[model samples]
Target: MTTAPIRLGTRRSALAMAQSSQVARALERVSGRSVELVQIVSEGDASRASLSQLGGTGVFATRLRDALRADECDLLVHSLKDLPTADAPGLLLAATPERADARDVVLTRDGTALADLAPGATVGTGSPRRIAQVRGENPGVEVRDLRGNVDSRMRRVRDGELDAIVLAAAGLSRLGAEIDLVAEPRDLAAWPAAAGQGSLAVETRADADAELLETLRALDDPRTRFAVIVERAILAGVEAGCHAPVGVHAVIDDDELRVRAAVYGAQPGDEVVVDRAEPLAQEYIRPQGSGKGADAASRVAHERASGIGALVAGLLLDRGAAELISPSTAS
Candidate 1:
């Protein structure tokens, strides 16, 4: 009997292909199953305007999720940062691989960091998060939205459309597209990064085959998973996305969680704010043991992380670090 192959859904972009292939390879090892890639052209890929015009956050992930729901694929893979804050009722984030470099890398013609860029030099990026931070750092510099896959964006710089571009360091490393990156951007005060930016998310439907689901779960990295939740919670709290400038970085070291977050206006030159936090020593905080020890611990940890994130975001907003958000969060 021929075993059914595990179908993995992915976007057509080079980064998406690389990420999807990595997950397929991992799943094959875990379940001894043949895996196949299903490329779903996303709306974001088809749209020519800015991502903000392409529809808000998750534009890149919705198509894959829909395919997963229709049973077209055994599982769907996504860049964790591109996923929206809300979860699909019938789908679950079965796993998140260990995180990669969470920093936003600055690629320039010269071997110079952000600080070394010439005065009034133009920086390129499609992310509002990067735009705000770049503008905030050097008001004298010009910032513009530069979209397309990594190579496409790099092409613009080579064609003299831009002097440098801000890209995820993890992406360049994954695609081996690093010759353009003049330097790696760092400093929470200056450039934090999108929440969950360097992680990958594996989604499986609620009714997916049991053995397959468990096999996929094996790819989950608990440390990275929790770290992303913490980071994403901050993004959700501030309601940051394609149109909003929000940066979040969370790390797990020695079983302790540390998060640094930043929020800025439409242009960083306008205003900016940043903050950091660390979860309490206790694994999770629960009030009077609401349930079984373990269950309560998980609940407590999630709530604590959420609360910490909210506190940091609120503090930043109140300080005029991030601009006023719409009445609704999905803005």
Candidate 2:
């Protein structure tokens, strides 16, 4: 018997559609059920205001999440970084596929590196984190507020309205957009990305069927899920919204998970940073998802990961991260 297709809700932007289509195909392969993409325009997509002005954290996710809760869609795909850390009522983030590159890249009109850009060069980005990072790297450059789809933002550089722009490398790769400009990759060691950056979040209602949940679980990459959990835990611990100037990156190496977090002040060169690593729980290092025993192991691993994240967040707060990342200072 043929099953009904899974309706996956996603934003209508080019990047969103591309990534959601990938998830749809993957769901089809794993569940042997067809999937349909439902185009949903979020407030973030419809608004002209900056992310900070739109309240940052849930602007991109709230509407789509509402659709899932109301049974308008069976599942939803979200750019993980755009999702708020707080859990939505009656919703579960079902899976996070293997991550793409999590680093931000600098795109320029004339093949000039960010550092080589002339003094007073105008750099455009809508993210507070990128604004602080750009200022920290080159205080002389003029950082301007910008919002739009990827193509429109790139057009600003082409039209000589801005000298450079910062964007996530994953979006460009997913869209397969041919960028003719010089794209310089930022070093994650020094320039950490937003929590859960470059990851896709698949969410569904909490009351989803056991079979469907299992099918979605087939898409989860334990390592990717663990990393993002830790990173987002730090974000939550600090009580900073997604729009705050906070950057967190986490990676698992062998038996250890290492994280780097930064909270930037409104002024350039004023920031609090925390770098920490912990040995992963044995269950986490081993492969997961076999049976009840594996499920128990997964729970234990998640607890340990969250504890480590809290520890790092405490360290940052001790060093004044809270003061630097106040809501009023987000922009």
Candidate 3:
């Protein structure tokens, strides 16, 4: 008997298409089921206004999720960072595939690194975190709010419309754009990434097809899942949005997962609160049998990650992170 093709919802942007195509191929490979792309135009993609004005966080994922709920598509793919921490009713964040490089890259016309950029240089980026970090690092450089697709942003650097632009290394890699100066993940003390920056979220309706759900579970990556879990937990704990001048990066060190968080106030030149969580065990469940306990390990990782995240957040708040970001934050 033949089965109907699974519909994977995606945005029409080049980056979105590239990522969604990857998910489609993975699903077909694991499930042996045909897949089709259903383009869903997101409000974020349609609007020319700032992301905050258009409603921060989840703007890109909202319409696709609406499509999934309306049965217009079977599932949707999203950049995990674009997903808001708030739970979506009737939707399950089913899986997070393996992550890519989670670093910020500075693209310049002269192939200059962030450290070498000239004083008063005009840098392009709409991210508050990047703005604050740039100012913190080099108080002279000017960061302008930039908005556009990957190619459009890159054009500014090449055409000399701007001296430089900061972008996600994972996005540049996925788009296959040539970038010379990347702030590596190893330099997290100076440039932590946005929570879930390099991860992909596979979301489906809560009442999704059982076979499809099984296929999604097969695509889950425990390490990636847990790493983003830690990162996102920190974000949620701080009550921050994608546009918030907050950065969180989580990584596995030996047998433990370590989460680093950075929060900046509204002013680009203001001080930042940088703190980390105690390294927690990578897996809560002991490995046994042929390693089929991956799901159980992920659950344990989530729990531990959450606990560590809450602890770290409380520490930062005590250190004045809340007041730094929002002057009106209750004491």
Q: Candidate 1 or 3, higher TM-score?
A: 3
| Candidate number with the higher lDDT (1 or 2) | 2
Q: Write the per-residue lDDT of candidate 3 for residues 281-301, one digit (tens) a residue.
A: 534423322234755665666
Off by over 4 Å in 3: 178-186, 277-279, 282-298, 327-331
The C-alpha RMSD in Å for every predicted model, in order, reads: 4.0, 1.5, 3.1
Candidate lDDT values, in order: 0.74, 0.90, 0.78
Candidate 2 residue-wise lDDT at 90: 98
Instruction: Report the lDDT tens digits of candidate 1 across residue range 1-331.
Output: 3378888999999999998898899888988879999999889888878876676688898888889888888789888888888767899887788888878777776666776677888888777667767776676788887778888888877777888888888887778775744565675445777888889999999887668766765776767767777778777776665345667787766746677776655644555455564745545422222236644665566677777777777776677654444333246
Write down the TM-score for model 3.
Answer: 0.91
Instruction: Report the Cα lDDT for candidate 2.
Output: 0.90
Instruction: Evaluate model 1: give its lDDT.
Output: 0.74
User: Weakest 10 consecutive residues, lDDT, candidate 3?
Assistant: 282-291
Model 1 clashing residue pairs (backbone): 273-321
- lDDT, model 2, position 200: 98
Q: Candidate 2: where are CA atoms >4 Å away?
A: 329-331
